[model samples]
Target chain A: MSLAEVAKNPAGTGQKLKLQHLGMVYGQDAESVPVLEDINLDVSDGEFVCIVGPSGCGKSTLLNVMAGFLPATAGTVTIDGEVVTGPDPRRILVFQERGVFPWLTVEGNIGFGLSKLTREERRQRIAHYVQAVRLQGFEHVYPSDLSGGMKQRLQVARALAVNPDILYLDEPFGALDFVTRVIMRGELHRIWQTERRTILFVTHDIDEAVQLADRVVVLSSRPARIQDILTIDIPHPRNISSPRYLQLRDDFFFWRNPVAGRDSSGPSSQQQPCWRYGISPFSGRPPRSFRRRLA
Target chain B: MKLPARFRPVLFIVLLLVGWQVAIDRHPAQILPGPIAVASGIVDLLRHGILFKYIVASLFRVTWGFSLAALLGIPLGLMLGWFQRGEMAFYPLIQIFRPISPLAWIPIAILWFGVGDSAAIFLIFVGCFFPMLLIAMTAVRNIPSIYINAGRNFGLSSSEFVTRVLYPAVIPQLLVGLRITLGIAWLVVVAAEMISVNSGLGFLIVDARNAGNRYDLVVAGMVIIGIIGLLLDLAMRSLENVKSFHWSSSEE
Candidate 1:
């Protein structure tokens, strides 16, 4: 269904978050730079949506606008038919870097939003989340003592502790190594499955987007607008080497760079996909061999 | 060949004492007392009980002055940092007054407080206040916006934000500031005592010099001051090793 059709019905019907004609501009008038333009999207309850675009394409800006950290220059964001005027605890934005409080222990970070609960209740809640995130043994350890993946998990645990209806993640695993990033993706998927919270994740890695998101929203470069929205029909725990996965991944590449896709489809395509050669399609530069072939 | 790191400081001190003894071997004790003469003078003051009284007087002034500055300056700084208009309005005044040495305030302090513990304390207060204020202000300004956003997203009330987020975020930086400002307070107290109060270590130095050229006692007062300053710094440095503050230093 179209986004406009989804917005016509208020969020209480089925939609978790509704954005209509969302636009963001930094500065005023003549000197103003438009960062995001004419963005319309709707996420259903318990759905996972990933936004992917080139670097500096204002994907983070869109997430920030939705999270109510920045007011949209135009249009509105509504959750469950309520207009989001400012940041609310019900919708938590997990930042890109290690957002877990450095000064707080793992337990303390999880219990941060639970100040209203009684002491015993808070302790139990903290313990529950610590176990949920597999940080049980490191309850008293601070974020600095944690590895990159552990810190991100702590951040996710902190967000989950508040029982937010929606979680907005901005390139959360962008800093992790390749192995850790894959591991964190699986961990996040497992947590989301159990928690069933609506997640809007923004990333540049198409592989990550396909692996984690139910619907991937592609954005143009600066002054970002939706380029395409592809739905992944595959089930959870998808085998990366499966033909369906490869087809979808290659389709995403071709959609982004049709000319390059056509060039690679010549006799050289019989070899192997560039991804198998450890080349990143999202890196904005093709492999040397591919470049040589094109030349 | 290579000394252990812990003993290096001790070795340096021993060499310093040897150099001092050699430099002063040909001079009369009245001209410049050697370390041995200063040691005897310290023992003599200890026997007379005057050294204890002087040290206590100096410490009492510093405690009052530094405590008052911290209590008042920290909150003021947090407010100024949190509120942009307040900072823009008052920061210029702080900058203008900061460069004036605490010693320069001596005459005015004496006039206001009438040449006693109060005058010495007032000068120390002036010495310590600005550094604390600036440090607290800078600490508040430097807190990562992510932390503030996180705190607000969790629906922290204004008071809760200050108590939980702002206060804890500023602590590691503030502790370092406090240590430096405390050193400044110590230095100002001695100077203030020399001119106004007649009952501190600073007074002992001036008094010893004037009364029959007791150079040994003057050197002894200097030694005591140095030792006390070192101890105060060591105490403050220990606070930095606290587990909660380990996040501020990346080495952890």
Candidate 2:
């Protein structure tokens, strides 16, 4: 459905976001290389889409281009059929690194860029996000004092406060501990249910992708191109222990595992490496690889 | 950070002072005035009101020069740090000029500005500018690219990126540079003052030396400089404490 079907005409009803034949390239000279290619996706007015891939794949690049943070070497991202030219308050991207304004407290961070609202209006919004993110009573504390999890939570509150039509979260929980990541994933789902907004998330964790996304799109290694898009028929508040959950999680791993077409994914110790796009994990040394078996 | 609990330099200082007192009294040399004699001369200078006037004049000169250097150096350093063109073009020239001693510039400063506070301050500026500028530029460049990209991804313009992200990221390093430069300024001020200034701590020491080797006045001036440098560093530390918005200790 288009954004026009879900909401009133000007507000965009049916389709909230559409990426048509998207491709991205970086570097100016002979080094120029495509990061994402031949990407076509349509997210409904209020759907959760997660893109998972090997670490070096261009998942983040695709989202960055959609947010208008990077130039798309080919194709276009449109909202309500209008092409994205630059970052708008309508589309806010929250990153994994916990990009909180150190100078601002929990409240101030949420209220930043909320220039259109009055002081009272902003206070109400700040208060709302504070509660939403379970960051209550941290209003006066500067970002420096918060733990890693709290800082990421603050980023979430800040992005949500702007009432972005579609939120872009680039591995928002990647930096957190396993426990915190699970908790935040749950909280994020709760927020989506309450707010009912479209969200595009990027993560290398197959379990995380399976847990959060209504549909999971897996991408190939460097010069990332979409490999497959799996619609998750599993119900909300998914149970990882359930047979269905385990199967969906296995499907993601099976494709990403270079040796999945063979019997074993690989030697238990040598799981497929997921290289993040754009960044050279190590210029000279070997690629950064996490070999822990997912299945 | 406060000194380590194991640090008890005061006992060592007292022992040194006692040793000085013993050496001077036992030898009784005219050229090497004893600690008591130096202490007496310091009292005498203070009583006569000369010490206060000289210290104030020296402070006036140093403050002007150091502050002026910071005003010029910080901006230049920030530019060098932030702008690729400026860094590539000016860094080599700055590196070459940086190694020259402040005294080398003193003679030129006197020729250009004449023998007064202006020339002395110019010499001090020369002493402080390079290190402060280099440090500031380094701080600007050292900010992790993650922070810069965060700003860019948010659609911050170039100026916004610098003002909001770059400057804040560089503050801790810049403050450290400020502390080092201030100490250098104090050292340069005293030496610069000794060359031509008629009324300052440097002159007082030289003037006293001219009249029968008044070691007391020289020792007193040196002690005063030490005290001032200590206080300025303390001030910078406090400023750092207040400005630190993120607690780094938690991470490392």
Compare the candidates by lDDT and give the number of the best one.
Answer: 1
Query: What do the candidate models score in CA lDDT, each in turn?
Result: 0.86, 0.78
Query: How close to the true structure is residue B9 of candidate 1, measured as C-alpha lDDT?
Result: 96
Cα misplacement distance, residue B65 of candidate 1 (Å): 0.9
* TM-score, B chain alone, candidates in order: 0.95, 0.91
DockQ of 1: 0.65
Chain A TM-score, each candidate: 0.85, 0.83
Weakest 10 consecutive residues of candidate 2 chain A by summed lDDT: A2-11
Tens digit of per-residue lDDT, candidate 1, span B1-252: 999999999999999999988889966544678989899999999999999999999999999999999998899998899898999998999999889999999999989999899999999999999988988889999999999999988999999998889888999899999999999999998899999989999999999989878999999999999999999999999998898875788523
Task: Write model 2 residue lDDT over A154-228, tens digit each, in one string.
Answer: 998888888888889999999889898998899899998888888999998777887888777777777777766
> Per-residue lDDT of B1-252 in model 2, one digit per residue for the tens?
676666669767778889989988888866566677777877888899988888789889889999999999999999888899999999998899999999899879989999998999999999999988899889888877656665665556677667767777777778778888988988888888888688888887777788777677778777777787798889877777764433332333
**CA deviation > 4 Å runs, candidate 1:** A1-13, A256-295, B1-5, B27-31, B250-252
Cα misplacement distance, residue A150 of candidate 2 (Å): 0.9
Give the DockQ of candidate 2. Answer: 0.26
Each candidate structure's TM-score, on Cα atoms with residue i matched to residue i, is: 0.90, 0.85
